[model samples]
Target chain A: MLKIHGIARSRAFRCIWAAEEAGLPYEVVPLGFAPGFKLERPLAINPNNKIPALEDGDLVLFESLAINLHIAAKAGAPLMPTGDDASRVMQWTLWTGTEVEAHVMRWGYNAYIKPEAERIASEAAAGKEALDLRLAVLERELAQRPYLVGNGFTVADLNLACVLYGPWLNGYDLAPFPKVKAWLDTCLTRPAALRARKLREG
Target chain B: MLKIHGIARSRAFRCIWAAEEAGLPYEVVPLGFAPGFKLERPLAINPNNKIPALEDGDLVLFESLAINLHIAAKAGAPLMPTGDDASRVMQWTLWTGTEVEAHVMRWGYNAYIKPEAERIASEAAAGKEALDLRLAVLERELAQRPYLVGNGFTVADLNLACVLYGPWLNGYDLAPFPKVKAWLDTCLTRPAALRARKLREG
Candidate 1:
């Protein structure tokens, strides 16, 4: 059985969601952010000491997006497209990480993660503005098509949806981008995502 | 023929290097950073108006690593590994972007891209420190092997080498991590990278 390290509350949730979507059996190692946890097992797997490290046979891998992509690829077919469509899927996946996720992280850290005294209103506002701009791009694209890549859902949607979950939970307004809002609604409600969300919340 | 838009000096160079490595015939659209350039053709393909967008037949894609991976996959074997090895390749590729490249971008922006008046010495110092820490990871990993994945060069090395190139050019010292320095030297010397570097310098 494949094993995943890290709590679902972290980016590891995406890996769990991917496993569920792929119908692959997986065991969660469940590392937490609690005191003394950082220097423990997670570090042994990932030098970065970040959540969401994966183990399969002799292979140990970190990075939630890579883990998700690997699971999707293993499952094959509709979960991971082929040829030109695969290129588009990769495009959206990378875009979500590089473009969308950074702004979300910025806004989220300021709005929730950072201590009140350290939070800068101006920086948070700028992050929100940047996020809105990126969201507008997604809104335009989603308005034209239901899914990010092909006519059906894939790991691209799963990865992107997980990134957006942060902003949504942080109470970022989704009103300006109705299509993106709808897309998120559709994505988050999927059985796999719902199971992952329950596991994360627990 | 495949088309890659953006100057070789930008992330687009990775796509060019990958195409050269894959032995795929490609054309360069040659975009510049001049004002108003962002609102033009680049936006038509990539809503973010970022360089390094790709067009192959009816498909359009962006994100340098993704483009490189796509090219390598199309080329197959040695350049792109399969199965568990492919997972490790993806892990390293994503790690380069999220961890290594961010610090490089930070230092580069402060050391070169930002105007001297706007540059922050403290932030640049922090970036350098962060970069050193990340490079240590690579140094330790590379000390064990010549390539990032498998026994030979792969897209993982190509992507990572391109990410490191910016910092290397900006005079970031590689002496502290001899293994990483040697690995990078090996990666950058490939004919494809040599061609890409020449195009970028011109």
Candidate 2:
């Protein structure tokens, strides 16, 4: 059986959602960080010691976004696509990781996740400010299409949506980007995404 | 021919290197930023207004790493591989983007790129400190293998090496991780990489 190592509440959430979307059966190994942000235990599969590593028989893979792509490809699902669509999938996935994830993460931690006294107001505001410009780009793209890649839902949508989830849940306003807001709403309510959300937030 | 829309000095350096390594004929369209860190003009290819967007026929792609992967794949060379090796390529590509690029860029800017008056000492120090732990992970992996996947130079190495170029040039000291230093030396000295560097630096 395929095994995904890490808690659903972590980046493993994206992988779990992808697996569900691909209709692939998998188990969560529950690896995570201990106090002081160290891994709970050494993970031979990933020297980086970060979680959401995937074990598919003898092949081990790390990076939640990469893992989701592998899961989707293995299932031969539309979530991964092929040819030019696959290239588009990769484009959006990398863009989300490099451009969107960090800002959204900073905003989420300061705005909702951290203890009230520990939060940095400036950090939260800066994150939101950075996100505003990127959201405008997303708004333009989504205004033309319902999903990131080709017409149907794909891992691109899944990856980007999962990164945006933090901001959406933390009350980051989407009032200025109606197309992004509508696309995000549609993405978050997918049956597979809801199933993963249950595991993460239940 | 592929039209790479960006200056060689930007993230386009990675794509240029990849195209060279893949032995593909491509043109550089020379899109770049104006003062105030904005694109010199609007880029319909990338709504984010980032450079390093790729145009091949009617297909357009942004994200330097993703574009490199596409170039390598189109060439059908060892740099892209296929099957499991392709997955490993994606793994390392995403890992470099997520775990290494930002820290290295921050360190690079504060250490060398930024003018003395604009440099932030604390930012450079913090970036280096964070990189130390991640470098240990890279050291372990490099100690075990000459290359990231399937015993050859691939886009994985290309993607990662390009990201590390900033720090390497700024003298971030890879001495503590000899294996990483050795691997990086081999990667950066490749004729294709040298060609790209000439364009970027000249």
Report every candidate's CA lDDT.
Answer: 0.86, 0.88
User: lDDT at A192 for candidate 1?
Assistant: 86
Model 2 residue runs over 4 Å out of place are A33-39, B33-39
TM-scores, chain A, per candidate: 0.94, 0.94
lDDT of 2 by residue, B95-166 (tens): 898888888977888999889899999999988988888888889888878998888899999999899888
Please state the error at residue A110 of candidate 2 in Å: 0.6
lDDT by residue (A15-53, candidate 2, tens digit) is 999989999999998777533444655777677777889
* Candidate 1: CAPRI quality band: medium
In terms of lDDT, the best-performing candidate is 2
The CA lDDT at B49 in model 1 is 80
Q: Candidate 1 regions off by >4 Å?
A: A34-42, A115-118, B34-42, B115-118
